[model samples]
Target: MELMGSMSVVEELREHYVAVVGSEPEYHEMRTRSGESVGVFEWPKGTSRMGVHLYASAGATRHGPGAREHAVELFLGVNTGSDAVKEGFANLILSVLKSNTVPQHGVFVAGNWKVIKGRKFTGWVLTERPDDLIPKLQLADGRHVVFLDALPVFPEEASYRRGNRSDELFEIWEESGLKSWDLDRDLPSVIERRSILRWPSWAQRNG
Candidate 1:
């Protein structure tokens, strides 16, 4: 096994996944419109699939020189390995890298997106990794890469997160007893309709 610091970022991440999940992942290649490509490493976990972006932090814009101490690699969990799901994450990561905004924890990027057909997830929350299975990775250059879970969210859930607190929405998901983050899971918004009434008039009207 290659030691830490000696391995490339992708190699280090692959090793971490192997160590934690005890299996090799299937590599899905995603190409940007500019012809650049990134690998989405996916692993099968029972009825679900977990994917990690291998190049989200390898650049110097978003996670490289611009934000070394706060670098993040995005990951997602879904009910199936849908191409649309992978594309959604890839597009989000690339979009962030190309924009002035840095991906921040507890923030949800809202859009009219359906990661998987027949599902109602309209955006994703950039939250801390669901578990400690994949720990922080330090590169040879001394920059550390943190993993974040790109949890799919409904519009109402996004509103709930914005109006209330991110953790409050997380708590509701925890109480939901459902796979809240799974893109293919047909999960309803856990935020009660009455809760929307407490938000601003704009939010109430929209949500």
Candidate 2:
């Protein structure tokens, strides 16, 4: 199916995919069937078997020298895909909200999340910072998309406006640096880069 972005899509998916501060940080654990701890954010109702806990956002500011415009970052397992699409993660969340039509991914609206219920919570953070705790996703299509637990999302790179959608949507995760970093070594520098790998977005749609 062709991936498309539209205002209607955003309006349609907002309610279900929104990540509001839960009542309790300690109780907001997303547990698997075997009581395996997942994440701090609450899972969608009836979603017992979670594959991954995705943290995606668009319109976040870019890092390094040329840091004027916003950029997109998709964090799963050990990979960090930058400039995901001009549209960013909103489209993917919207698609996931649709459920049957798109892959099932768990995402939260990007914002400063120091406290869930007026308490300092290090368990779950909103803004990105790689080498932190994150999760993988079990999309609706029964696909397991893996990514790094820690995010490369930086405050300076965080967008003032909540990343919704930009002109570029179909572009998806076409960046080349998905697996170019060595998580075992340095994440920012270039060493013996790992062979390129497919993006979670690619597996979600093209699968």
Tens digits of per-residue lDDT for model 1, 46-80: 51223432222223124333344555677766556
Model 2 per-residue lDDT tens digits across residues 82-153: 222111333333323233221112222323332112212111112232432333333332333233222222
Candidate 1 segments exceeding 4 Å error: 1-7, 34-36, 46-67, 100-102, 161-164, 181-207
> lDDT for each of the candidates?
0.55, 0.25
Residue 37 local lDDT, model 2: 27
Residue 90's lDDT within candidate 1 is 65
Candidate 2 at 199: error in angstroms? 31
Where model 2 places Cα greater than 4 Å from the true spot, the runs are: 1-76, 79-108, 114-152, 160-207
In candidate 1, how many Å is residue 135 off? 1.1
